[model samples]
Target: MAFLESVFAVIGDLTWGWALIPILVVLGIFITALTGFAQFRFFRRMFRVLWPGNQSGDPNAISAREALLVSVGGRVGGGNIAGVAVAITLGGPGAVFWMWAIALVGMATSLVECSLAQLFKRREPDGMFRGGPARSIIHGLGADYMWLAMLYAVCLIAAFAIGFNAFQGNTVAGAAQDSLGIDRIWTGAVLTVVAGFIVFGGIHRIAKAADIVVPVMAVAYLAMTVVVILLNITAVPEVLSSIVLNAFGLEEAVGGGMGAALAQGLRRGLFSNEAGLGSAPNVAATADVRHPISQGITQSLSVFIDTILICSCTAFVILLGGVYVPGAEAIDGVVLTQQSLAWHLGDWTQYFLTFILLLFAFSSIIYNYYLGENALSVLTESSVARNALRVIVMGIVFLGAVAPDATSVFFFSDPLMGVLALVNLIAIMMLLPTCLRILRDFRQQLAAGVARPVLNPEDFPDFDLDRTAWTGIDPDRR
Candidate 1:
C-alpha cells in the first residue's frame, strides 16, 4: 500500500510540478489583458443575465438560473470545505492569501476557457449541449489534433472516475462513520442507489437535482459557518490579520515563510474551483445557451462564488474556531474540517456536516459520471462502449464510498487529476486567441445595440453585429 502511494506521489509531483503554475499564471494574465479584463467589465451585464425569467424562454438554452445552478453543481464541491482545510493545514494562514490570488486569476481563466467551450459547443442528436476543450481543440486546432483531444478525454475519465469521485465518496463515508458510526458499506450502497437514479436520468435531471440541492446545501453550509464565526466574532479581526500576515510570512508564528504558504493556497484554490483543470468546462458546456460567452460569464461567477465565497467561508470557520494548528502534520483531507466544525458546534454538528458532505459528494458522483460520459463520447463512436463506460463509472461510486480513508482516496485522485490539468491547460493556452476574438466581436455588438445571437457554427461567417439593431428589449438585456 505504501509503495503504491509512493508511486502515485511521484507521478503527482511529475504531473503537477512547480513549472506549470507560472505558465498558467502567465496565460491567465495574458487572457485577462487580451479581453481588456472582460470578466470585470461585463460583471453587471452578467448579473442581469442571471435574473430569474431573464433568457427563460430561449429555446436554445436552459434558463440562466438553471445554467447557473448546474454550473454551481460543478463548482461547489468537496474542495470548498475539505480542500480549504487541507490548504490551511498544509500552508498555514498565509495559504489563504494565495487561495484568493488564485481565484482572482482563476476567474479570468475560467471565463476564457468556458467561453471557448461555448464557442465550439455542439448539439447532440439527443438535443443536449456538450462542449469544452474537446470540442474547442477539434474545432479550433483542426481534426489532426483529435488524438491529443482524445488523450485529454482519457485523462479526464481516469481522473474523475478513480480520483475525484473516489475522493468525494470517501469524504462522505468518512464523515458519516465519524459522526454516526454508520458502516461504510451501508453508506456506500445507499449512495450508489441514489446516485444511479440521477446519473442514468442524464443532464436535465442532473441539472434539476443540482438546482434544487446546490442552493439549499450551500445556504445551509454558509449559515453554519456564519454561526461559528459569529460566536467567535471577537476572533475575526485576529483571524484576518493572521491570514494576511502569514500569507506573506510577515508573521513569526506561521513559521513556513512566504513561499510554502503561497504554494499550499494556490494549489488548493485551483483544486477548489477547478478553474484551469477543465472539469468545470464540461459542466459549463451543457448549458443550453445561444452564445458560448453567456455560459462563460455564468461560469466565471461560479468560480467566485465557489472559491471566494464558499471556500472562504470554510477557511474562516476553521481558523476562527481555533482548530488550525501550525505545527501539526498537514491535515491531509476532510477530517480536519470535520474536527474543527465538531469542536465549535459539538457532536450534533458532525452529523449535520456529514449530511452536507453527503449532498456534496452525491452531487459530485453524478457530475463526475456525466463528465466521464462526455469524455467517452470523444473516444468512441460506439453507443455500446459509451453505455458500458457509464455502467463502469456508476460501479466506481461504491468503490469511492467504501474507501478506507481520506489520504488513500486523495492518493488515487491527485495524480490522474494532475495529468488532466496539465493536458487541459495546454489546450486552453492554444484556444486563447479564438476566445479573445469572440469576446472582441461580442463586445462590439453589445456597444452597437445589435446583439444578435450566434446560434450555429455556420453563422460564424455571417455573425456581423454592426448591421442589426436591437428592436424590443430582451428581458435578459436589463
Candidate 2:
C-alpha cells in the first residue's frame, strides 16, 4: 500500500503538477479565443437559457436549469470552502486573483466541451441522454479509438465515482467532528444511508435534489459572506489590492510568491469549477435543450458561479476576518475556514459551518455518483452491475468517513482526475471544429430572430452524430 501511494503521488505530481494544469490553461485560452470570447459575448444569453419553465418536456431528459444545478452541485463542493482556505493559507491572498483568472478562460473551455457532449450524446434505452468524453471520443473520433473512450470511462469511474466520494466523505466527517462534536463513525453511517437512498434512484433524483439544495446552500453561504464583508467593509479595498499585487509577486507575506500563488490558485480553482477537467460534460450532456450551445453556455455559467462567486465568498470571509496567520503551520483546510468564521461570527458559527459543510459535501457526493454511473453505463448495461457498484460506492463513503487519514485517497484520486482531464482535453481539441460549427449554426438561428435556437443534425451531414437523438426539431416547441 505504501508503494502504491508513492506511485500515485509521483504520477499525480507529474500529471497535475507539470502537464495537465498548463494544458488546461492553454486550452481554456485557445477556446476563449476561438469562440471570440463567447463566455463574455453571450454572458447574458447564458442566464437567458436558465429562464424558468424552459423544460424540454422529454421525460427522460432534465431541464437545462436542472442540469446546471446538477453540475453546480458537483462543482461547488468542500473545495469551495476548505479548499479555498487551503489555497489562501499556502498561496496567500494573491491566489484568489489567479482563481478568477482561470475561471475567465475556463468558462470558454466548459462551453466547448459541454457543447460537444450534447452533439454526440446518445439516448439510452431508459430514455436518458448520456454522453461525455467517452461517447464523444468514440462517436466523434470513430471506433478505431474506442479503447481511448473506454480508458476515459475507467478513469472517470475511479476518480469521480469512488475516489472523490471517499475524499468528500472524509471532509464531511472531519467538519462534523470538529464543529458539531459528532463521531466520525456516526457521520459516515448517516452519510452512507442518505447517499444510498438518492443514488439508488439514479440521475433524476440526483438532479431534483441538486436543483433544490444547490441554490439554497449557495445563497445562504453567500449571504453569510456578505455579512462578514460588510463587517470588514473598511478593509475591502486593501484586501482587493493585496490579491492583485500578490498574484503578480508584489506581496511578501507567508506563502507569498507569484509561483506559489499561481499554482495554488489554478489547482483549487480547477478543482472547484472543473471547467476544463471534463467532469461537467458528463452531466452537461444529460440536459435536454434545443441547441447544444444553450446547454454549453449554461454550464459555462456554472464555472463563474462556482469559483468566481462562491469560492470568492470564502476567500473574503477568511481574509476579512483576519484570522489567517502568515507562515503559520496551524492554519489550513476546513479548520482554517472554521476558525475564521468563528473569529468573526462567534463560537456558534462553527456549528453553522458544520451544517453547511454537510450540505455542500453531500450534494457533491450525489453529483459524483451520477458521473460514475454514466461511466458504468459505458462498460455495462446490467442493472445488477450498476446496483453492485452503488453498494460498493456507499461502502467506500462509509470507510472514508471513518478513516483516520485521507492522504492516500487524495493522492490516488488527484492523478486519476489529471489523467481524465488530459484525455478529455485531447479529445475535445480533436473535435473543436465540430463544436465551432455547432456554435455558428446556433448563433445564426438566434441572429435570425429565433427565440430559442434549434439544432438539426442534417445541417452537419459530415459529422458523426446520433441522428435519432437529434431527429426532432424542438420537442418543447412542438
Candidate 3:
C-alpha cells in the first residue's frame, strides 16, 4: 500500500504540481483575454436567463437554466467544502487567494469549452442533446482528432467517474462516521443503494434530483458560513491580510510557502468548480437552447457559484473560527472544516454540516454517473456497456467508502484528474476560433435588440454541426 501510495504521489506531483498548473493558469488567462473577458460581459445575462421558468416544456429536453443547476449539482460537493479545508490545511490562507484566482480565470475557460460543447453537440435518444470535450474534438476538429476524442472519453471515465466518485464516497462515509458515529461500512452500504436507484433512473431523473438538491445544499451551507462570518466580523481584516501575506510567502502560515499554496489552490479549485477540466461541458451540452452561448453563459455561472461563493465560504469559516492553527500538524479535510464550524456555532452544527456534505457528495455522484454515461455513449451506444459501467461505479463507491486510507485515495485520483485537464484544455484550444465566433455572433444579436439569440447552423460553412438541432429545429424530437 505504501509503495502504491508513493507511486501515485510521484505521478500526482509530476502532473498537478509541475506540469498542469502553469498550463491551466496560462490557458485560462489566454482564453479569458481571447474572449474579451466574456465572463464579465455575460455576467448579468447569466442571472437573467437562469430563472426556472426558462426551462424547456419538453420532458426529454433540459433547458439552459436547468442545465446550470444540474451542473452545479456536480460542481458543488465535497470539493467546495472539504476541498477548501484541505487547501487551507495544506496550502495555508494564501491558498484561498489562489483558489480565487483560478475561479476568476476559469470562468472564461469554462465559457469557451462549454459553448464549444453545445456548438458541436450531437442529438441523443436519451436526452435532447449530448456533447462534451470528446464531442468537440470529434466534430469540431474533424476525423483526424478521433483518437484524441476517444482518449478524452477514456480519461474522463477513469478520472471523474472512477477516481472522483471514490473521493466523494470517501468523504461521505468519513463525514458520517465523524458526525453521526455511523460505521463506515454501513454508511457505504446505504449510500451505494441510494445512489444506485438514481444512477439507473437516467438523465431526466438525475436532472430533477439535482434541481432540488443543489439550491437547498447551497443555502444550508452558506447560511452556516454567514453566521460564522458575522460572529467574526471584526477579524475579517486580519484574516484577509494573512491570506495575502501568506500567499506571497511574506508570512509563514502552513506547509512550504507560496509554491505549496499555489499548487493546492489550482488543483483543489479545479476539483471544486472544474472550470477547464471538460467535466461540466458533458452536462452543459445536454441543454436544449436556441443558442449554444446561452448554455455556455449559464455554465460559467456554475464556476462562480462553486468556487467563488461556496469554496470561499468554506475557507472563511475555517480561517475566521480560530480553529485552524498556522503550521498545524497534518490536517484532515473533512475533520478540519467540521471542527471549525463546531468551534464557531456549536457541536450540533457538526451534524448539520455532515448532512449538507452528504447531500453535496451524493448529488456529485449522480452527476459523475452521467459524465460516465456520456463518455461511454461517445464511445459506444450499447445498453449492456452503460449498465455494466454503472454497476462498476456503485462498486467503486462501496470500496472507496470502506477503504482505510483517505490520503491514498487522493494520491490515486489527483494524477488522473490532471490528465483530464491536460487533454480537455488542448482540445478546447484547438476549437477556440469557433468559440470566439459564436461569442461574437451572440453579442451582435444581443446588441441588435434580439431578446433571445438563435444560432443558424449555416452561419459557419467551415464546420458541420447538427443541422437538426440548430435550424429546422424540433423543440422536442430529434
TM-score of each: 0.90, 0.96, 0.93
In candidate 3, which residue ranges exceed 4 Å CA deviation? 1-13, 405-412, 472-478
Q: For candidate 3, which ten residues in a row score worst on lDDT?
A: 469-478
Error of 1 at 411 (Å): 5.1
lDDT of 1 at 337: 82
lDDT of 3 by residue, 1-478 (tens): 7998888778788877788878888999999898999999889888865676666667667777668888998999877877888889889899999999999999999888999999988886554688899989888888998998888788788877888888888888888887799999998898899999989988877887887888899888889899899989999999999999988999977768998898888888877888888899999998888888888888989999999898989999999986788787857787788889889988998899889978988998999999999999989999999999999999988888988574355566667677777889888888898888988998887887777788877778787798877873333422
- For model 1, residues 1-478, the per-residue Cα lDDT tens digits are 8888889888777867755667667777877887788778877666666566556455644565666776777668888877888778777888888898888788889988888776666777776677777877887778898887888898888888556777676778877887799998899889888877887777778878887888888889999998988899998999899989998788844556788798888888877778888888887777656556767887888888888788988999888775667767666557778778888989678788888888888777777887888888888768788767667765677786786853354564667777767877888887777676777666665677755444334435533221121122354543
Quote the positional error of residue 301 for candidate 3 in Å. 0.6
C-alpha lDDT (0 to 100) for residue 164 of candidate 3: 80
TM-score of 2: 0.96
Of candidates 3 and 1, the better by lDDT? 3
N/CA/C clash count, model 1: 4
Every model's Cα RMSD, please? 3.8, 1.7, 2.8
Name the Cα RMSD for model 1.
3.8
**How do these models rank on lDDT, best leading?**
2, 3, 1
